[model samples]
Target: MDCLFCKIAEKEIPSDLIHEDEFVVAFKDINPQAPVHFLIVPKIHIKSLDQISKEDNALISHIFNLIPKLANELGIENGYRVVNNCGPDGGQTVDHIHFHVLGKREMLWPPG
Candidate 1:
């Protein structure tokens, strides 16, 4: 288990964690893209979203349910962006599933 996010979730690595439950954890991105940028990841190593199985439904729902609250807590209530890059062609760098919460600025369309 050399996964970075897994280490963070397990408290083996230090991260500016904002929220966490039995299922998922939210923390600030090491390299933020905006004034506020964070990531929500499942504690269980599920790889990418594309790799999610039907058995992960409940956990997935719970994680999704916490997204808005996480955004609001981070002060992005006015508006924010949630991005899930699935695979290489989709710009996914890490081999784990994560939701990127970005805000604190007006986002441009068609992300260049």
Candidate 2:
């Protein structure tokens, strides 16, 4: 119940938020890795991708659908990358599940 992302979702902590709905919230990453970098997180914390359950299908779909819409709004027509780090070894720094939207620059292969 003491999750950082949860606080952001609850508006308990201020963030550079771009989009917010009943299911998810999108905000600019504090430590941006590219020209355009942000995070889309579910309101309900599911730890990481591995924790997602069948009941979260609709929520997961909604987040994916919103990603491109947001990218277009940002004018990233060149290309973009949606990265999700599932676990610690996968480079997941946070325990909560979130998607990183990086664009406005060409993403190379073998992103590590």
Candidate 3:
């Protein structure tokens, strides 16, 4: 597949990977918004949040279950933000689904 995250997950392209397991792949964000910014992407290609099926329940659950540990490991134990943009209006740039984890700074309300 031509998806960038797919390439990264497949090791077809290199990223500053922080974590990887059978269900997901994570790496530092290329354009970080905070001192600690990274992404968690599912290895399986899901076009967007709108596309997830009931069959994806376990995968989604696993992603949520893994986030805190990763956030702590990334040194954001004090606090962190997890964002998943669903569509164009929501600021989703890439087609593949991903969750942004960012912290080490005071997060503002009404995040733009």
Candidate 4:
């Protein structure tokens, strides 16, 4: 697969890894929008939020379950933003499913 996040998860590409497990991986975002900007992605490719199936329930839950711990570890316990862009109209740049975890700054309303 030519997916960038997949390459990173498989260690085929270098990334500043923050956390990893059998199910998911977290890493620093190269083009950061905030002081603390990272990405959380599933090891298995799911395309986008619109593609998620019932079979992905456990994996999705696992990802959410790790967010708080990851935020605390990264020192953004006070506040953070988790964003999942679904498609072109939704601002999704990568085909692989991923969530942007942003913090260390005030996230204004009416986000673009």
Candidate-wise lDDT, in order: 0.89, 0.95, 0.94, 0.94
Candidate 2 worst ten-residue window by lDDT:
103-112
> Taking the tens digit of each residue's C-alpha lDDT, what string does model 2 give over 26-54?
99999998999999999998899999999
lDDT of 4: 0.94
lDDT of 3 at 55: 99
lDDT of model 3 at position 107: 94
Worst 10 residues of 1 by lDDT: 69-78
lDDT of 1 by residue, 11-68 (tens): 9999999998888889999999889999999999988988999999998888878988
For residue 76, what is the lDDT in candidate 2? 88
Q: For model 3, give the RMSD to the true fold.
A: 0.8
Sort the predicted structures by lDDT, highest score first.
Answer: 2, 4, 3, 1
Clashes in model 1: which pairs? none
Q: How many backbone clashes does candidate 4 have?
A: 0
Candidate 4 pairs with clashing backbones? none
Error of 3 at 97 (Å): 0.7
